[model samples]
Target: MVADNLKRLKDEIAETASRFNRNPDEINLLAVTKLADVDMIRRAYDSGHRDFGENYVQKIIPKMKILPADINWHFIGHIQKNKINKIIGKFALIHSVDSQHIAEAMEFRASNNDIVQDILIEVDSSGEIQKNGIPIDESNELVHFITENCPHLNLLGLMTVAPFTDDRKVIASCFEKVRNLRDGLEIDGLKLPHLSMGMTNDWKIAIE
Candidate 1:
């Protein structure tokens, strides 16, 4: 069942990216494995799905231990300060970096661990107060802070979560906001190549 769903999802992602004239390889379909047991996750893995997103630190720690070492585990949850030390060198990429303080903490942890942590600055582009992200207005400052001061943190791109709405225009606006923010933030020596947005409800619109 999971494999079938995974194939359909990948096909849809490919189709959508192709429609936008985007190389489907440029769009990674991160299998959100939250609430999934190791066996369930392994089923997706066995089906050739490797990149996975998890919302909690505790849940992913053990799974990482048992899973294939090459699996790209993404930290897609709101990060807590207390666990900054816990995930220093663990994740392949972090998509929920919501503030300057959090980025600083991650930098400290990464420097101490002797590893550079790659992350995306999460922006509240949709203006959803209940969601976790840096407000779009102040995201540029956070991006600059990481680039100028945090030697251990690699600011690869930006991330945002669009509200779960049937209105395709609204979802597309949120994704566009984040992409524009990323473009505006880039300078001569820096380039943010990734934009992590969209989910099951609005994935098609996101790629388009």
Candidate 2:
């Protein structure tokens, strides 16, 4: 069931990319394994899936011990200051960095380990107070801060979540804002090559 689901999801992603004239190869499908069972993960792995996302260090560590060594683990959850040590040299990418404090803590940990941590700045373009992200207005400052001060941190791009509503227009508006934000942010010769937006709910709109 997991293998079939993964294949179907990949196919849909490819079709969406084609609709936007985007190369499907450039679009990475990160299987978020927060609720996935070990057997389910194995099924996807057997199907040639390597990249996986986890919401917490405690959960990912145990899974890492049992999983193959080459799996690229992406930490896509809210990062805590104290948990920085657990994630520093482990995850291939951290997708929810929003504050200077978090970035600074990550930088310290990465510098100590002599490793550069790749990350995406989470932006709250949805204006939802309940969400965890740097506000869209303050995102530029956060991006600049990471690029200038945090040498051990690689600011890859921006990530945002669209509001949880069935309105396609609203979701597309949120995604467009983030894309435009990413474009405008490359001012000081900074190139943000990725935009990590989309999820189970509104991923198709995100591709468009």
Candidate 1 deviant stretches above 4 angstroms: 187-189
The digit string of per-residue lDDT tens for model 1 on 1-208 reads: 9999999888888988888899999899988888798999999999998899988998899889999998999999999999888777899999989888898889888988889889988899878779899998998788889899999999899888999888888888989888877777674456999899888788777788
Q: Pick the candidate with the highest TM-score.
A: 2
> Could you report the Cα RMSD, in angstroms, for every candidate shown?
1.2, 1.0
TM-score of 1: 0.96
* TM-score versus the correct structure, for each prediction: 0.96, 0.97
lDDT of 2 by residue, 1-208 (tens): 8888889999999998998998999888989999987888888999999999999899879889998999999998998898989998899999999899999999999999999999999999889989999999999899889999999999999999899999999999999999999888786688999899899998888888
The per-model lDDT (C-alpha) reads: 0.88, 0.91
Of the candidates shown, which would achieve the greatest lDDT relative to the real structure? 2
RMSD of 2: 1.0
